[model samples]
Target: MIDKRCSDTELVSLYQTGNEAAFEMLLHRHKSRVYTAIYLIVKDRYEAEDLLQDTFIKAINTIKAGRYNEEGKFLPWVCRIAHNLAIDHFRKRKRYPEVTLEDGSQLFDSMRFAEESYEDKQMFRDTRSRMRDLIKELPDEQKQVLIMRHYLQMTFQEIAERTEVSINTALGRMRYALINLRKKMIKNNIAYDENFYPKRFDQVSIPRGQQGPDERD
Candidate 1:
């Protein structure tokens, strides 16, 4: 019998060596998180279920073909596959949902920029647009951390688990992401304002229950 406490790395290794039960264990352990990730994006239970199955099927095929190299970081790797599949699903349908802020602003989160004039708001919008472009210029690891934390609204601990890194590593990546973004902003002649963007990960507000009072790097 396979130990229920077996690590993901152990389960993956056993599965690679022809133990089908190990693969099943892996699926059982991670299925909920994977499904949730898909559901959050697709916002449809049936569609999330279908994509979840497709995700594991793709992973199974890759493992069978001896191409699985993710090793210890199994969950994050699988989550990324599911994320891509969900994105592709929307792309194929050509109907992407608009993420809105509390005040009905589209695409941008509920960040209150202290703008009092039409010109200021328009400048803020243009800055945000350029910021998105700058984000694309970040290194893949940094970009992934940034998107997962800011856009996905994931907690640091959750980000660490999904990215298969320590909390400090996740926090460090975010810090560097902000630094890099600020550098790009200066290079592009955009003003850097801490009130508009988080200059540090710790300054970003954590949801009430998502983080403890003592949680920090």
Candidate 2:
């Protein structure tokens, strides 16, 4: 019973005009990408689905309250809402499970061995598997920061605010994490290039004009 002719933005505008079916159309258009982003972070299909529903509900309320602003793309705005909601869910739970790529099908497999031959594929798989295991060996704080920075594409300042640490502290934890991961790779005789990871944490100089850590509080 959905109108296939209308675009997402048009559907959103209709919803704002009190057309209920238009909201359903918008939800149908964006649900997959929003769910995928949440699943990538939460790593649970059921949880991702639940979060996706909740996200849409929240978005509806936001629009109803006249708080929705048409920004970049409608999908990315939905994605940001889902991302923040997932983060809040984890914070409230106080313990989050490690995200696995096992459920991600061929898409996950392709990322690790996209450029290699059959022979190299198996080798890359083995190496990447071992590296993931070693990454798990890092301390929780370090692991969270690294995952947020690399996997979630969060900046150092974002990680600091999320983890309730100073930017310098977040940078320091990332530095130590890299050193530990590198040491593990070396010990296992793995030939990972240092450039593949965040290695310039030491070279990051805080700007002088920025407020000091003490001043912000």
Candidate 3:
């Protein structure tokens, strides 16, 4: 198992060296804040989760493409991704009065909004279903923390008090829960959106050993 204590820099270095576990650690460490940030903006549980997965996919694809440049500030970068995506989501909703599938892709061979309850939006159901499946695999303690925090809207202190664990311990369980869930997702090739991202993160093909800093992250 990768050490949970590794700094962001160390973890990134390991991830750059082709360690997916290291990336899982990074995801675990940062997921809650990213989820919370998106939820605060979108104010919907399902859409917030959809954006959360997009943000992670963006970061992961960027890292794999060797475009990730973070001078030890991974969390901020992801949080920014989440914030920007959330803003984009709001703009799209305002600009277009219809609903697209998850990641806001309409199935009429267009990225625009689709008719309500359209069959083409089936991909969104797949996305949510996949996430639900992985969430079921979380350990009992971590599941409690996740439900109380995300579902019950409890703060860390409140969760700790209710669970009779230290705040750090409660936080740790949540982190592990995220990591475990993500591991299952990756294993199953799950994504919140079936469509490829608009960004060029997918087009860049850099091998692991060839990745080097091209700009300040």
RMSD of every candidate to native, in Å, equals: 14.8, 12.4, 15.6
Regions more than 4 Å wrong, model 2 = 1-5, 96-217
TM-score of each: 0.49, 0.45, 0.44
**C-alpha lDDT (0 to 100) for residue 88 of candidate 2:** 68
Error of 3 at 91 (Å): 1.1
Cα lDDT tens digits, model 1, 125-212, are: 6776576557767775676677666644467998687667799999999999999998998899988575885442113356767886
Q: For residue 168, what is the lDDT in candidate 1?
A: 97
Evaluated with TM-score, which candidate comes out highest? 1
Superposition TM-score, candidate 1 onto the true structure: 0.49
lDDT of each: 0.68, 0.65, 0.64
lDDT by residue (tens digit), candidate 2, 1-217: 5467666677778888889898877776666557656654564567778998898888888888988886525665676578677766665554523432222112121122223245433544676657765766777667667766754456798768766689999999999999999999999888866576543211223566875663443
TM-score attained by model 3: 0.44
Candidates ranked, most accurate by lDDT first:
1, 2, 3
Tens digit of lDDT per residue, candidate 3, span 91-164?
66664334333344321121122232343245446656456546646666676577556533457887687567
